[model samples]
Target: MILRSQRPLKLKAAFICDISLETFVSIIKTAYSYFTLLLYIAN
Candidate 1:
């Protein structure tokens, strides 16, 4: 009975984790691009 109640919470957690992972990747990509652009300008 306890496991049944927790099932939805587990799914919600997994969904949130997936979203955070995607956001993290996108942030890193944006930062990387900005860094490269700065380097090019410095040259």
Candidate 2:
């Protein structure tokens, strides 16, 4: 939920970093999943 909400910021960050969309998307997905997993574990 939070991750979905962060998409705009994430895309901005990715652009600022000059990362290709394909690569940036993969990275974002990986990080988002990691964060959600962490949250699940915490709860």
Candidate 3:
């Protein structure tokens, strides 16, 4: 049925969204750590 097919697609989209959000958060954390390290070195 069409509903069954759409269910998988919705799950896939949700998974992709979760992955992208995790990646974005990781990148921000890495950048923040690097910035902090640089500031520490400068001081």
Candidate 4:
């Protein structure tokens, strides 16, 4: 019974971790785009 409960918790943690990683990746992409645009405009 304890094992069953732990399985769901582990799955939930993995799902949350994946979501956080995706979000961080998106944020980095957006920042890179914005920085490139600024450099183009400056030149």
Stretches of candidate 2 exceeding 4 Å from the true structure: 1-18
**For candidate 4, what is the lDDT?**
0.68
TM-scores, all candidates, are: 0.56, 0.55, 0.56, 0.56
Residue 10: error of model 4 in Å? Answer: 13
Model 2, 1-43: lDDT tens digits are 9889766542356356555578778988999999999999999
Q: After superposing candidate 4 on the true structure, give the runs of residues whose Cα lies further than 4 Å from its correct spot.
A: 1-19
Residue 18 miss distance in model 2 (angstroms) = 5.0
| lDDT per residue (tens digit) for residues 1-43 in model 4 | 8888565322234455534455666778999999999999999
Whole-model Cα lDDT of every candidate shown, in order: 0.69, 0.75, 0.68, 0.68
Provide C-alpha RMSD values for all models, in order: 7.8, 10.7, 8.1, 8.0
* Candidate 3 residue-wise lDDT at 7: 47
Clashing pairs in 4: none
Looking at candidate 3, the ten consecutive residues that score lowest on lDDT are 7-16
TM-score of 3: 0.56
What is the number of backbone collisions in each predicted candidate, taken in the order shown?
0, 0, 0, 0
lDDT of 3 by residue, 1-43 (tens): 9878664332234455534455666778999999999999999
Q: List the residue pairs that clash in candidate 3.
A: none
Better of 2 and 3 by TM-score: 3
